[model samples]
Target chain A: MQSGEDLNQDFRPETEAGGLTIRLDVFQGPLDLLLHLIKREEVDIWNIPIARITEQYLEYLEIMKELNINVAAEWLVMASTLIFIKSRMLLPREPAPENAEETEDDPRTELVYQLLEHQKFKNAAEMLFTREEVENAVWNRPPDEVLEDGGDVIAVTLFDLLRAFQEVVRRFESQRVMEVAQEEVTIEQKIEDIRKCFLVHDQLQFSSFFTAASSKRYIIVTFLALLELVRLREIWLFQQQVFEEIQVSRIKESA
Target chain B: MQAVMEAIIYVAEEPVKAEQFQEVFPEESPEAIRRALAELLESFNARPGGMWIREVAGGYRMTTRPEHHEQIRAYLKTRPGAKLSMAALETLAVIAYKQPVTLAEILAIRGKKSSSSLQTLLERKLVCILGRKEVVGRPILYGTSREFLIHFGLNSLADLPTLEEFAQMAGDQL
Candidate 1:
C-alpha cells in the first residue's frame, strides 16, 4: 500500500529501483495494457481524457524499453493510435452534427469504443482463467463413465494416426527422389500392394508397406492407400501399446 | 433409488440428465429425482475420498479430486493429462463467450495469429468447427464443444462467470 494511488497499482508493471527487470509476461496484448491503464486511472471508459491516458501509456513503454523488455509491434501501434487521438483532442473541435449534442460527440469516441469492446473480452478471459485454474484440479473419471460412446477403437483421430504414421515412416523411408513420370504409383495400386502383403500375414507393421520402396513417392503412396483403407473401415491401425509398433488388422465383417 | 442413481451416474459415460432417469422410472417425478441427486451430493461431500460426483455439462459424473492431482498424475504416468497453453486458453475463452466466431474474429480479439492454437484446440476436441461463417472466405465458424464444457467443469454455457467479476474482486483487494 506504500505510495499506492489506485487499486490496479499492483498489476501495473512494477519497476525495480536500482535494478532493471520487469515481467512482460503479464501483458497479453496492446488492449490488455490499455485496460490496465483505464483501471489504474479509474477513468470513465465512455468519456476518456486522451491526453492523460496517452501520456501514461507512453511512459509505460519508456520504462519497458529501459528495462529491456521486448515489446511487440501491436503495443507500439496502439501507442501511436493514442497519441493521434490525444493530438486530435488538443485541437479545436469541429461543429457538432445537426441532431448531436456538442459535448456528446468527440474525436475520442471511436478509440473509447474499441477499448470498451476489448474490455468485455478481457473480462471473459479472466473468467476462463479461473475456470481453468479450478478445473485443473478436477480429473475425468476412468472409462467406467461413458460420456462418449461407441467402440473405443483406441480413440485415434486422423491427425493422431498421421503423427503415428510419421514416426514409423521415419524408420524405413529411403531418401531417393522419384520423378512423376518414372513412378506413377496410383493409390489404388498401393492399396492392392498392401492387400497382397496382408495375405501373407494376418497383421503387418506400419513400415512394412514401404518395404523395398526406392523413392519417397512409393512410401507416400503406400501411406495414403493405408489411410484410404482405414477410412473405409476395411482395416484398423493401432499400436499394441503407446510408442509400440503400429499394427494393421483386417476388420471382422462376419462378426 | 438414490443408490441406483449413484451407480448410474458413476457408470454413465456422459452426464446423466434427470430426464433420462425420469424416462426409466415413468411414474417418478423430476423433483424426486432432483432430491435424490441432492442427497447423493450431500453424502459424497461428506466423504473425504479422492473421487466425487459432480454435475458437469448438464449431467452428473464422478471426477477425481484436485488435491489428489499430483498423486494421480504420478499413477497415470503412461497417459497424458488434458493440459492447455496460456495462448490456447485465452483463445478458448474468447470462443467460449463469442461462439460461432471465425479465425479472423479470434485474431482480432487476441491481437495475434491464432491458427496454431485453433488447430491444437480442435485436436483436443475442446473447440469444434460449427460450419462456415457466411463471410468473405466462408471461413469455418468455431465454438466450444461438449468436451470443452466437461473439461472446464461447466454445467452449461450459463455457468461462465463474467470477466468483470474477477476485476471487481481485484479492485476490492486493492
Candidate 2:
C-alpha cells in the first residue's frame, strides 16, 4: 500500500513536467478507479496482469495526490489488498494440492465478482431513475399516479419498509432490558393482553405497551404479538418525526 | 383464509395488509384479524415466494425478498425508460444532502434557478415541504420524503451518505 505522500512524491514529475491538471473527484475511491481502468483496458478479470493493473492503480493514486484529494482509508485498504494479491501471484507456487485438479478457479475471481456485482446494482439504480424521467415526460398525469381497480393493493415505498424495520428494531432494543416479573406468559396470553390494551385505549405509546413485560421471552412474545397486530393492520404505528416515539392506534375494521 | 391472503399478496403488484382482508370479512374482530394475519405470515414464511409481506410505513406491504433483488433488477432492466437523468440525480442529491432546505438555497448551491427541477421532485414525491422557514420571506423548507428513503433503500435521513463523501466527490470538479 502506498501512502498519499509517497504516491505524491513518486508522481511529482508527471504533474510538474507534464503540465496536466489532475482531479481526484473523478474517482469515488480506488475500487471505482480500478473498475474504470479495468473496463477501459478491457482486461480479462481471471487473467489480470497484476503488474499493469498495479501501475495504473498507483498512477491514479499519484494523480489523486497531485490534485490534493483527501483520500480515505478505504482506498488505502484496497491498494494494500491489490498489492498483497499481486505479490501472492508473483510468489513461487507449491505443487498443486490433490483437490486443485477439481477446480481451476482463479484467486482474483472473487474480487472481480464483487466489483461486477457492485457495478451491476449501481447501473440498475441509474436505470430506474432514467425510467422515471421518461415516464414523467410521456404522461401528463396527476401528481399522484393512481392505479385504479387494485383495491387491496397498497403501494408501500422503500422508505416505508425502512421505517417499519426501524420501528421493530427500536422496539426490540428499548424493551430488551426491563423485565416484568410475573407468572410465565404464553403467546396466546400476550395476544390477549395486547388486545385488551387496544380495546381500552384508542392509541398507545408503542413503548408503553412493552414497559410492563419483565422476561426476555415475554418481550419476544409481546413483540411478536405487536408484529401480528401490525401484519393484520389491527394497529397502525405513526411517528410524525423520525426517531420520535411511535404512537400505535387501533384500526377499526369498519373504518 | 391464509391461502387467500397468500393468493392476494402473490397476485397484487403492491403490498397488501391484514386490514385489507377486513374488507372481505367486515364483521371480524381485531383479535380475529391478528390471528388471520399470524396464520398468513406463517404460511408465507413456510413456503417459498419471491415476495413477502412486511409491516412498513404503518401498514403491511409486500416487497420482493432481499434474496431476489438481483432477479428483480434483471426484470427491471427488461423495462425501458426507467433510468434517472444526471440532472435529476444531482437535484435529488442536493435535496438529500441539504434537506429541509429551501428552493432558494438549492438554487444557490446549484448556482442556477431550479424551480422546474424542484417542481418535478415535488411531483414525484421524492422531496416534500417540511415546513416554512421563518425568514423574511418565509420560504417553504424542502426535505427528502420517505419515498426518497425507500428509493435509496435508506432507513432514515441519518442513513444518507456522509457529507465527507459528498465533499470528496465534489472535489473532482475542483
Candidate 3:
C-alpha cells in the first residue's frame, strides 16, 4: 500500500484503466467510507491531501459503479463535494480584508468538521454494537402463561452448556501463557471417562466434568464427547430454570 | 408491598415505574410505593439468583444477571431476533446522542441520506417523532424512544457513556 505522501505521485491514467481492485462492504454512509480511506492512508484528518483523497475516493466509486453496486445519490453528492473542494484548493487564495481579523475559512474546514463529528458516532455505533452483543445473552422472564403445570425440566439449552464451556476455556487461558499438553486424549476416551463418572455419581455439574481439562484440544474433545452422549440418548442435560447451571445425568431407561 | 411490586415487575412486558404503581394503589403514598420498590430492588439484587430486578428506561423490571448471560443466550438462540444493520445502528447512535434533531441535521453529519435507516428505526420503535422543528420547512424531529434505553439496558439517556469515555476505553484496550 502506498503511504499518504506517495498518493501525490500521479497514476491517474493507469488507475482509470485498471479501475483499482477494491472490495466494497456496505458503508453506513459517505463519511464512513471517507474515514476508512483516511485511516487506510494514515493521513492527518486535520490536513487531508484533498487531491489524492478525492482521486482514491472517486476510484472506489467507479469500481462500485462497475460492479453494479447501487451507489446512493448521497455518495455521488459527496463525490461532487470532493471534486468541488479539490478545485477550490487549486485556486489562488482570496486576499483578506484590511480590517478583518479572522482569516478566510479553509474550504476543507466544513468537510473536516463533518468528518470528525461523523467519526465520533461511528465509534459510538461500534460501542453500541458491543453492548447489544453482550446484552443479547441476558434473558428476561417471558410473559406469563395462563396455566401452569409442574414438570421436571429435562432439556438444557445449548447456551448453558456453552457458558460452562467458556468458563473452562477462560480459566485455562488465564492460567497459562503457553499450553503444551504432553498427553493426548481422544473423544472416545473422554466418553468412557464420563461413563465411569456416572457410575459413581448419578449427575455431574456440566462444568465440573471439565475440571481436569488442561488444553484447548482436551476441552474441545470433552465437550464433543458430551454432545455425542446427548445425541446417542446415553445422557440427559437439564436446567431447572432460565440461566441456571446445567446438570448432566443418564437418560435412564423407562420401565 | 415488596412482594406485590416484585410480582408486578415479573409480569410486566415493559419496565414498571414506581409512579405508575401509584395509579394502581391510589390510596398509597407515592413515597411509600417508592420505598417498597427500593426495598424490592435491594432484596432481588442481593439474592444470588439467575434473574433480578433491574432499573432500566426509568422503570423497574426483571432481567437475567449479566453473569448468566451465556446460559440465557443459549436458550434464546432457538428464537433468533433481527439485528440492526450498520446504517440503522449508526442512525440510531446519532439520534441517541443528539436527540430531538432533524433529518437535515442527521444528513449533514452523516454526509448521506439516512431516511431509510430512520424508517427502520421508526418501524423498530427505537426512534420516535418528537415533533416538527418549527423552522422554515418544519422538518420532523426525531428522538430515542423509551424502548431504546430499555433495549440497550440503560437507566436513562444519562446512562449512556460520553463519546469521549468510549474513546478512552477503546484507547486503553489497544
Candidate 4:
C-alpha cells in the first residue's frame, strides 16, 4: 500500500474514459460516492441516471482494488444494489393497463431518499467532528474536584445503577426455584414487602433484598417496583464507592 | 436553595441526584426542591461560562460544554500519565464496540482478567453496566457511559474511530 504522501504524489489530473477521477478520501462509503456523482452530474435523485452513477461507482471500486484497500461487504452490497437499480431502469417502462393508476411509484425514490438522508447525517457528523477538533486544540481543565460540601454526595451513573439491578436479579434467579414452591407473589405485594423491609432497616445491603425465598418472577417484579418508586420520585439508589453495595432508601421528597 | 444546590455540586465529586439535594433541604417539599432545581438549570443554561450543569446517569452535575472539550484536552495533555492506560483503552474499546457485553466476553477478547480494570474504568466514569444479559448465566452487561462520550469529546458512539482503524493502530503499536 502507498503511504498517504505517495498516493498524493501519484495523483494525476488526467481524467478516465468517463471524465471522472474520484479521490477515495472524499468518500465515506459507496452511497456517499454515488451521491457525489449524482449531484455533480445534476441528475435527479428521483430519476437518477443509473448508467452514469454505476460507471463511476465501478471505477471507484476498481481504484480501491488497485490500491489494495480491502472492500467491506457493505460496499459490495451497494454495488449489486446499484447494478439492480440500473438494470431496472434500462428496461422499458410498460404502459399501465387502461384502468390502472397513471404512474407507478419510481423504484429509485426510496433508495435515493435514504441516500440523501444518510449523506445529511454523515455531513452533520463530519461538521461536528471538525468543530470538536478545533475546540480540543485550545481548551484545558483539571479533573473535577471532589465535592466538599457536607451534604454533597457522589451520584452513581446509570450504568452502575443498571449493573446493581442486574446483580439483584442474578442473586434472585439463583434462589428462584425454592421460592416458587413456597408461594405465589405479585409485584404490588413485592413492593409492599420491600417498603416494609426498608421501613425496618435503615439501609439494606442490596444483595439481602433477594433471598433464597425470592423467585425469579418475584425478583423481577420487585425490581420493576423499585424502579417505579425511583421514577415516581419516591425512592433513590446510591453507591458509596466502586464495586460497593448499592443502597436504596425512601426519598424524603419533602424537605 | 440555589446556593445550596450549587455548593453541593461544587463539593460532590460524583454526580448528585435531586434526591440527594432533598437530603440537604429536608424541610422542602419534593415539588419545591424540583422547582428550585429547574431554576438552577435555567440559571446555568443562561450562563456564559465554559462549564454547564448537565443531568447525567440520574443526577445533576457540572461538566464542561462539548464546545470546550479541546481546551480540556490541551490542559490534560500537559499532565503525564493522565492519559488512559492501555488496559483501560482496551477495556473501553471492547465496551464501545460490543456494548451491553459481559465481563466474560471482554475477558475472552482480551485474554486476561479485566475485573479490576473494568472497576477502575467504572470509577473513572468511562464505562458503565448496561444491564444483565438474559442468558444462561445472566452475566452483567457493560457498555460505555454518556460521560464516556463527553470525556472523549464525542456526541455519540458512532464518533469513535472504526474498529478496523483501531485494530490497525493497535497492530502498529504492538
lDDT (Cα atoms) of all candidates against the true structure: 0.73, 0.60, 0.77, 0.64
Range of the 10 consecutive residues with the lowest summed lDDT in candidate 3 chain A: A7-16
**With candidate 3 superimposed using the best TM-score fit, by how many Å does residue A54's alpha carbon deviate from the native?**
1.3
Error of 4 at B151 (Å): 5.9
Model 4, B1-174: lDDT tens per residue?
998898777655456777898888889999999999889989987999887776644667666676765566576554222455445565676677778899998765544466876988887777877889999988999988877765555556766567555444423322
lDDT of model 4, residue A182: 61
* lDDT (tens digit, per residue) of candidate 3 on A191-212: 9999998888877888887777
Docking class of 2: incorrect
Model 1 Cα RMSD, 1 decimal? 7.8
Comparing candidate 1 with candidate 3, which one achieves the higher lDDT? Answer: 3
- In terms of DockQ, the best-performing candidate is 1
Model 4 residue A36 lDDT? 61
Rank list by DockQ: 1, 3, 4, 2
By TM-score, how accurate is candidate 4?
0.45
**Looking at model 1 chain B, which ten-residue stretch has the lowest summed lDDT?**
B165-174
* Per-prediction TM-score, chain B alone: 0.85, 0.59, 0.86, 0.53
List model 2 lDDT by residue over B1-174, tens digit each: 667766665554333556777876678876797798887777776678665665443344455566654555476453333344444555666677777788888654443345766777775678888999999999999887877654544445665446555344323311
What TM-score would every model get versus the actual structure? 0.66, 0.34, 0.63, 0.45
Tell me the tens digit of each residue's lDDT in model 4 across A1-255.
121333334333344576565434545356556666666676766567778888877877877777656576667878898888788877887876788754355557667655654443343334434433443443233234222322223456678778877887766565545332567777788778877876776556655666544566666777787777777766677766666777776665342
Measured by lDDT, the strongest candidate is: 3
How much lDDT does candidate 2 score? 0.60
User: Residue B110, candidate 2: how far off, in angstroms?
Assistant: 27
* Fold similarity of candidate 1's chain A to the true chain A, as a TM-score: 0.60
List candidate 2 stretches off by more than 4 Å.
A1-26, A98-106, A135-255, B1-174
